[model samples]
Target: MSRRSLARFVALAAILSMFGTSAAVMPAQAADQVIKIGIDLPVSGADASDGIPTQNGAALAVDEANAHAPKGIKFAVDALDDAVGGVHNPQQGATNIRSLAADPAVMGVVGPFNSNVAAAEIPVSNESGLPLISPSNTNPTLTKTAKYRTAHPNEITYFRVCATDDVQGKAGAEFAKTLGLKKVYIIDDNETYGLGLANVFEKDFKEMGGAVLGHDHITANQQDFKALLTKVAATKPDAVYYGGTTSTGGGLVRQQMGAAGMDPAKVKYEGGDGISDAEFIKVAGDAANNSYYTVAAPNAAKSASAQAFINAYKAKYHSDIGAYSANGYVAAQVIIAAAEKAIKANGGKAPTRAQVLKNIQNTSGFKSIIGTFGFDKNGDTTSPVIALWTIKNGAQDFVHQINVSTK
Candidate 1:
């Protein structure tokens, strides 16, 4: 064995060792490609019962995706609260979306539950070319009207999985009539969502030959509603339809109706999805009886496809799913499908926000936990459904669902 031969062998061995190390290190580095899904919702204060459950649904999807993610891909959730004090704030939502958009790793977003917050965040997200898939923004103006688009009216970056107010309001009015509610009074919170729903319900009720005794708007944070209830009582209305959320005076109005000479159980109390939450029942207490409401999405808990999701949700959060929880999961699923496509198109690398947005816009035949649906040109769900609910024995009971009619 000559020294020269031994030196040559040593050099070759070192080269092979270094090559082996590089091969092992490359996969670990590639596995670090983290794609984040930003969740902007009112996850604090009174809204937590709704927002936290919705956020939990998205988070649960992320967890499940990571379990089966491709070798070099991983998913994460970046959650931000848009709640200020006790309710959702538009400015906070805009700020949260801007923060999420500036992050290059965030491929898409899944929230801003309230329609009003969505209105404020849409322009910002659209300007940034960031995709936002909402679980619950149901106001018609967010997608039907062009004013909220900022300067990019033609380019849609916001999509929602829920039915719009036009359908929900009409459904509420129809249901009221079904209960023989002939004369009714209407009240709204004066916010974008509440006022819009109230107006639609009013028109539909009138067209259905039901008398609208009077209509009113409640001021923000107005605690004492006895005066308004007294005025409403004077109309001798057979029912009172509130077009606002529990946080925005839905439960309070129903609770105070007795002081205004109307028995909460005898006189029908109706509202939109805003009041179809556990918080509403908590707020209205025993007065919650005889209360009817509607949800913009189908009854996910009843869907066979959603059973696994519901069980997973309960197992993870140790609580029942909220009204929009499955909708949130569906929104995340849409983004996940689009992100997977974008990554493959980019050769297994993280894709650009624009690429992901374009893929989401092209989402078709998406089978979600809720149902089989796709996004229309306006970013609205191709199949829209509304669920009716009632408070019975101090719990939410699902009545039935309506397939929204465009006409």
Candidate 2:
């Protein structure tokens, strides 16, 4: 060959060799790498009963996401215990966030399951520009704050799969009104979640012209609420509103009310999403019967996508799906979808945390197992559908799905 032809051939060979080297390195990079997702839930304390399942649901989602991930990326979940002693402490939640944030590998976070915990940890994630999607946190104050807007101006980094307490409390009040409840006693656990939700319910119930017989507060770890129940029973209220989780508040519903000589059927009990679980039914037992709860709309298990998820979850874990599991799964789905979009937008390169946050905030009308989900400007789920369920014969049966809007 002539000198020019040989030079061209040598250049082509050098380019081909570089391409071969890069191709060989790509699979090793994919295999050795992982996209980290942080999970903060009370996995080892009093709240573990609720938290463990949520963690499991999140893990299941991660597994499924990895199994179906596009050729170049794999997902890994870093499940951290936010449970401190017997409580889901905000300090612990914040610590978890700091730890996750310090690691540059984590693209997003899945929780701090309790709204109380979210109150502490979300700001940290916000400062770090890490998108934190909560599966269960419902406090309205989270997304309504000026700080949230100031910190996350481009897109709301904080998103939730569930409806907020503003919607949940209103749904509870409406349900009580529908039942013709005239007078009700409100009790809260004094935590961020309990107090916030209780206040909302109390306001709405009273504004509806219903009577608020009395309101009380209790510590979350307290086991005895007989004195409070006695005072509430003396008020002759038609119903009682509990604003806390099953771990701290469920037994009070049955034991304290029974000790006060109040017949379970005679007094209606209502609570927010915290008490809407199978564990609450177990803890409250017979008292749980006829009790009502407000929760995010029930997973339409009949939907083909939902059923497929249920089946995959059951087959993988050999456990039945619970009230919060599907929500947790959907929360993971949202994060993964956002990450995938970000990666694609980055031309097959892994996205940085800022890019992921932007992608998540810009996520509009993404199809999820729960339904079509999009966040409002405030980071709240735009789909404000709450479901009222009644415990009948030891099972929570769906009563009605209420479509609510602040407008």
**Candidate achieving the largest lDDT:** 1
* Runs with alpha carbons beyond 4 Å of true place in candidate 2: 1-30, 147-155, 405-407
Q: Give all candidates' CA lDDT scores.
A: 0.90, 0.80
- Tell me which residue pairs clash in candidate 2: none
What does candidate 2's lDDT look like per residue over 356-390, in tens digits? 87777777887877777788877777776687888
What is the TM-score of each predicted model, taking all chains together?
0.93, 0.88
Q: Report the CA-based lDDT of candidate 1 relative to the real structure.
A: 0.90
The TM-score measured for candidate 1 stands at: 0.93
lDDT per residue as tens, model 1, 223-318: 899888999988898889998888888888898899889998788899999998788889888999999998999999789889999999999989
- The backbone clash count of each candidate, in order, is 0, 0
User: Which candidate number has the best TM-score?
Assistant: 1
333 Cα displacement, candidate 2 (Å)? 1.6
